[model samples]
Target: MRHRRSIDLMPREDAADDGATLELLPEWYVLVAKCGKCRHQGRIDRRLVANRRGWGVSLNSIGPALKCVRCGNREGNKLLLGRLPRD
Candidate 1:
C-alpha cells in the first residue's frame, strides 16, 4: 500500500497581503524595500531578515525599522512584494 500526503494550499490568517510575517510569505514571492527619500530599491531575503529579527516579525514593522544603505534615509521606507522568476 502507498501512503498519500495532503498539503495545505491555503494561506494562514496571519499571512495577509502586507501585515504578514517574513515566513508567512510564499516561496514564489520575494520582499523588496524601497527608500522614499532617495528612491533606491533593494531586495530583501526573508530568511536573513527572519534570522535577524525573528520569524514572527511583521512586514509593516520592518520597513520603518530599516535604513536605506545608499542615502541613509531612515524615514518613509516601504516594503513591497516581488515575484521570483519561474525559471
Candidate 2:
C-alpha cells in the first residue's frame, strides 16, 4: 500500500500561488519533521526552505519528501509546520 501524506498546513493549491507570498511563510514556520517509525524528530531552519523554489511543487509537497537523517527512511516521515510563538 502506498502511504500518502497531506500538507495540511496549507492547501496544496494555495502554496503554489507565488514565491513572494510563499517566502513569507518560512519566517512564520517552526519546521518540525518527525519519523513515523523511529519517532525521531528534527527542526529545519527557514533559510534552507527559502532557497528551494521547487517550481510546480507546492510547499506542502516538500514536507513528506523529507528523509529521516537518522534512519534514512522516507516513508512515514511527517512534517509539521508550526507558527513561532508571539512575543
Candidate 3:
C-alpha cells in the first residue's frame, strides 16, 4: 500500500500599497566584482541590485556574467563587489 502526503496551498494577499508614505531617496552605486586572474571588473550601479543574499550572491543573476575581456579565461573569476573585505 502507498501512502499519500498532504500538501498545503494558500493564496497570500498582496500589500503593495497599504497606506504607507513613500519618500524620495538619493541615488546609489553598484558594487562590482573583479576577476582576480585577468583583472576584469564588473560594475553595478547602487540604485540597482540590493544587498547581498545568503552566503553570497552569484554573478550570473545580477548582470551578464562577464568573461575575461583581456585573457578570455572564465575560471577563477572573483566577485569584486557587494562583499566585505577579508580579514
Candidate 4:
C-alpha cells in the first residue's frame, strides 16, 4: 500500500488573549525559559515537558511550574517559544 508522509500540525490557538498548549505546537518551535531572578536563559524540550505534565497544559501555565536550573528561582520564570531550523 502507498503511504503519505506525516505532517506536523501548527499551533491552532495562538491568540492575543491566551497562549497555545503543547498539543497545538509544532516540533520545530521549541520552548525557551528565562529565570526572573538571575536572568538565566535556558531551552527546554517540549517532549520532556509533555511527558511530565501532559500535553494539555498551556504555555502560560508552564512558567510557574518551572524552577530555574541556574539560580533555583521558583517563581516568575517566563516561557517563550523559539523556532528551530527547518533545514
Against the unseen true structure, what C-alpha lDDT does each candidate score?
A: 0.70, 0.59, 0.37, 0.72
Comparing candidate 3 with candidate 4, which one achieves the higher lDDT?
Answer: 4
Residue-wise lDDT of candidate 1 within 1-87, one digit each (tens)? 222212222212223354567777678877778887998888878888888899989876887787898999999877766666669
Provide the lowest-lDDT 10-residue window in model 4. Answer: 4-13
Local accuracy of candidate 2 as per-residue lDDT tens digits, 1-87: 222333334323343444433354546556677777787878866556557744344556665677888998898776666566557
Q: Which tens-of-lDDT digit does each residue in 11-78 have in candidate 4?
A: 22233245568888777777888788998888888888999999998876787788999989988877
Worst 10 residues of 3 by lDDT: 5-14
lDDT of 4: 0.72
Best-to-worst order by lDDT is 4, 1, 2, 3
Point out where model 4 deviates above 4 Å: 1-16
The residue ranges of model 3 lying beyond 4 angstroms of the native Cα positions read 1-27, 42-65, 82-87
Candidate with the greatest TM-score versus the true structure: 4
Clashing pairs in 1: none
Please list the Cα RMSD from the true structure of every candidate, rounded to 1 decimal place.
Answer: 9.4, 7.1, 15.4, 8.8
lDDT by residue (4-87, candidate 3, tens digit) is 212121111122222211111112212464555766765544333333332233333333343555777666654333333335
Question: Which pairs of residues collide in candidate 4?
Answer: none
**lDDT score, residue 18, model 2?**
44
Best lDDT among the predictions, by candidate number = 4
Output the better candidate (2/3) by lDDT: 2
